[model samples]
Target: MPTFPAQPSPANKSIALCVLFPVFFLAILVSHFTLLRLPYFWDEGGYYVPAALDFFRTGTLIPQSTVTNAHPPLPTIVMAGWWKIFGFHILATRVLVCLFAAAALLAVFRLTRTLLGEKAAWVATLLTAIYPVWFAQSTLAHADIFAAAFTLWAIALYLEPSEDRPQLKVAALFSLAALSKETAIVTPLALAIYELSLALRASRNRAVPKIPATKHLKSFAALSAPVLPLLTWYGYHRFKTGFIFGNPEFLRYNATANLSAYRIFLCLYHRIVHLTLHMNMFVAVACAIAAILMPAIAPRARLSHPVVTAISVILAANLLEFSILGGALLTRYLLPMYPLVILICVAIWQSHMARLQWFWLAGLTAVAFLAGIWINPPYAFAPEDNLTYRDMIVVHQQAIDFLQAHYPEATVLTAWPAAAEISRPDLGYTTHPYKFVAIENFSLIQIQRAASDPSGYDTALLFATKWAPPQNALSLSRHNSANDAKYFDFHLDLLPNEAAAILHGEVVWKTSRGGEWAAILHFPRIVDARLNPPR
Candidate 1:
């Protein structure tokens, strides 16, 4: 074993940071190719890749996706720049997401070290590095990784020693985070509220002592600083897209479907705590218990040093995420929180280097790794994640080449969401030709829009769903009985969508691989809504 320096002086912190950061990042960069070579999952193909292509070709900041509303444009728009250099390689595009994810990991490691101690920090970092959700999401072109990294940076900057420049940096990071995803806008405000709480606590202890007026003023400014960016972007998006949010799809999701306030809130919170507990109920429980014990640990750990301050800022961010976004429902959402928690854990280990404490640290790290953080959950999810990653770019690549050569610049309408958005949301919806209410879901509006509006464009090709498999078992809803299940459960047992039924038209393309070991199907139906799917 090559022994290394345990604790470098504050001056040498920069060198240590420089050395470890790249090593951790490269581990992911190398691991990405080794692990998998499936095509871009679903949304990466649908929303992200297309938006990147649009942004790259059009050079537009607003990367307008065909899906048009569920999320913000920053992730896709930024991906355009990467596509410029990487030249449409999924591996190369993933590297950008991976870099952001690496940044998030480094942030988590530093956060843990600051709050807890070196040992605990390492434990937390190791856990974070291997967490399946974190590992998976980092390798995909999703906004969460960027949001997470910037979120951590914002928390770090906010928690810095009461300095003006640091406050400004915090503001900038928060702004960038918000840009990455609309949900992140709530983070900074949550952070501000927490700092206010700290200020009040300190004030209570000192009636006669002069208040840290400068810090409060700075906090207010930091809190207010984001208004400019929000307003500017709001105006820009509104003017560009004829809507304030700039995406009609989000509006539809919000007004028509999507989780209600109570549901969203409950789901988000349950998601976070559950994931934490699932990773290790004890670690989650331990963190909660340790928080109550912080007053005692702070005095012993010299943690009142900058480490504690950083933890405070991150705690503020965590609260903001929980309160505003409802919770870090997913690990990617808590990427910033991971660092803060790690720092706190590290600080805790440093406070008392007892046998039990080290054992606890080991236990937590072991559990987190077992939970599969190293693979990253949010990105690299299995079949569930498949829809997000299955961009069908490989399929599309051939299609694109064929179309460009034969029917140059024609618009293509694909049946599988992967062909269009490469995301599953399309398939999730049932078109009006058949309504299987018992199925997971179907967006009537999305069906009408996609199916009805093909006449306006000269689309050359349609990449239809070649195969369908049960992603999960479906239980009948209250509104549905056995008969209702037939439509969605299988093509052979479909029901009427008004007068229409499943496979309700001429079967144009059907093959059994010429008496070999395969099956193929191509069927189209014209719906009552005038939404025709070609055979």
Candidate 2:
């Protein structure tokens, strides 16, 4: 195994952490300044913000407004507590999430510095901070960033020198991570299994002499400790909700429905692509792969054997666990893993390239990542993956504004999250709630169904619910009536004009940006004076 510089002194480490965190937070806040007060987008409006609002208003762990997903309450608790102090504003919510992102970056820096060196740490942390998913997620009130921060801290502690390692602290951090997001339990669980394997190997082979087999057993015990709290959360959830995981639909969508063998296989392929290629991650991955073919120029540039083994275990476990679990193959679910991937890539670059060459390579990788934040890929993806989410919010806000200004009394037919946006002022879309008739989406079939009852609503709000890039590769391969409806929750949305024609309405206002679009339709209807008389 190769070695790097000595770890920084305790005082120096403290100073560095203090400096790095604010710098990271400032960078994130400045980058997201325009987005800070924008209305919640997609799942934020659909679930997280509502769940947190329920807690803020009622002091309940289980959300009353949204369908309870049995996600742990740490994010809701934090958001509610922050709202208590800051008075429940979108800017406050976004700033709190940005703090979590900065903490995660600080953990990344510490972990990389300990394992490699300061220079590698700087490069890895910078890359992670600007990586499209991390950048986009930084200001979003989602549990993933909360979980990623604690999980990275736990991993950093776990990777510390054995003499300085704090087993209880690591277990506590892992528990906090699991509390932040249930799926985050997978990390400590994976590590526990790794420790158990090591203990078994150590007991069987006497040649392995550094730490006793008993120490590995102790490590396993610490890692397994997080499971207890997670189970307690589920038990409490069952007691309250009569369900262990979540409501039936939540369980079926996230777990049971995802159990098919073919779907798991397909998901594994997508997971691999998500980790290696999504959002221009392929640039760094490709650079690292090419560097692997070259001779080592710096003996101290490699990660220690144990560090490599631990990272491999984590990567494999998360890849397989997430492949078999999540209904949506969201990149944000694997947030902590990106920093590790980038660290390894940086280490590989340091090992083979000259200083100037490594600088150029890192610079190119950063440029690619920055470009990815603005450029939509030519495939189907969640708009939340990049700045496209801002477009979604802007266009939706425009449509809602049109409705507010011109047809405030019209019952607007629309789909979530527009449904949620127009109905919830707390989400930052409107001052007063609008009367909305909700549908699943603006798909042709759904619109046709809504058209059947024209008397129910006088206006329609429509949007592109899914990204359908021209010549979308994934759409070509994966989109079929059965598979899309069953697996992807996907449908082809009618254009605003087509939808209005079917609904016997005219398009009143519409807007489009970055392949995302939203429109409002107005229907003329006779008013019954006796039923709805002027005041």
Candidate 3:
């Protein structure tokens, strides 16, 4: 086995592993179990859970009739099968996803142990398990944790010294990563670069005879051959749908080759700024400086370091992919790099900062973990921040209760999130649930259809949440104004002004909870007032 910079005593290593696993597991469990019942917020209710239900009904890989080719079908299908077996309950699905989370924690521990040392492995695993984003994402039914787990395991196996059929195992693991998420195709690319870098270092050291650059290129290409299955999947989609991935609308709105360079810079800037601001600002800034200065301060140790090289490649590939392809730039888009970010911090600490009291390192990790709680919890710190699971749960539950009590049979005008919640029979609303129309990018026309305004549906519910013009139009709305196009992917163009115009009527019921606002507007009253204006 190859030795790393830090090798703890065998007894110490065993003690660390024994202590780390249970503590990390308990942290994840305690942190996530409470949030499990927080209704399918964000993409869970909006797309994934519904797609899983659709898969259950249709028995096909393409779960949604909308067939968002934006992603491969693996996550949705897996969730669907789990839902079928376990029954479609929020806690059950969340627990299933948590199993993936546990796998990720194990992968992180093993990878760090193999490359760094047992002590570093404990630090990395604890950092990963406690890190707010990874913890929160693990609880949610998303493909990201699954992809990250598979990719981490794949890289771990790829770095391992030769065992029987190691290459084959690595190849299969990479394939699994791709199956979990399309962007995971970058895993093998990063690994290929890592391999080539090692070969180059070996040749320079006279460990092997100098080889032609073309030979190295060919070898890298061969290592990347496992990505062919991913290519074939995209090919099948193209052949069937005439669109390359699935969601042409998403591609149209988010991608542009002509402006890829510009988009790349902007996206990277956005991500970096958000990371620094929301994800433990001080620690984030410190980590960035450490990663930058590590090479200059310790060139020899930094340059040829296998783990650092692999992490750098993976991070670079992820950034380049999003920059070039340019779609709805979200924090989640950078999730594959989350583990890398934690690992980079661990590497820096292991290299030069270990002399500091051990509690200092643990203190910083604790700060990052706490920062995530505020980020993930609704109205925990930011009152108007709707970028949380709790916001949806609190607001949607109020609206659902109001509608059930008064307008039991009324058609509810809802966006995807609320629509998905109301449509479900198991939510304890009523035996016969209310009807709803699930619209995204809300508009007056959509509201009209959802309410069945002209027909006999007398009451309409406009379950409004964080809808306002961008506070930072210069940054967020640079591409388009709120009146023209959505500034962010989650925020609709239904600005306060637009919503007021549509929702002008006698308010039957209203509730404001967890930084989200909900209201039920009387359609008849609004119509009568419009027709018979009082003298």
Q: Can you give the TM-score per candidate against the true fold?
A: 0.65, 0.94, 0.78
Q: Report the candidate with higher lDDT, 1 versus 3.
A: 3
What's the C-alpha lDDT at position 522 in model 2? 89
Instruction: Give model 2's TM-score versus the native structure.
Output: 0.94
Which stretches of model 1 miss by more than 4 angstroms? 1-15, 35-37, 70-73, 161-165, 196-211, 252-265, 278-331, 341-364, 371-416, 419-535
**Best of the candidates, lDDT:** 2
Which residue runs of candidate 3 sit more than 4 Å off their true CA positions? Answer: 1-27, 64-66, 161-165, 193-223, 235-243, 254-260, 274-277, 281-284, 287-304, 354-358, 375-387, 424-433, 437-460, 463-502, 525-535
Candidate 3 lowest-lDDT run of ten? 377-386
Q: What is the C-alpha lDDT profile of model 3 across 164-264, one tens digit per residue?
A: 22666677778877877888887687667766775665557644444444444454665587688788878877776677866766676666432545546
lDDT of candidates 1 onward, in order: 0.50, 0.86, 0.61
lDDT of 1 by residue, 60-83 (tens): 756654545435567877787787
Cα-based RMSD of candidate 1: 9.7
Q: How accurate locally is residue 303 in candidate 1, as Cα lDDT from 0 to 100?
A: 52
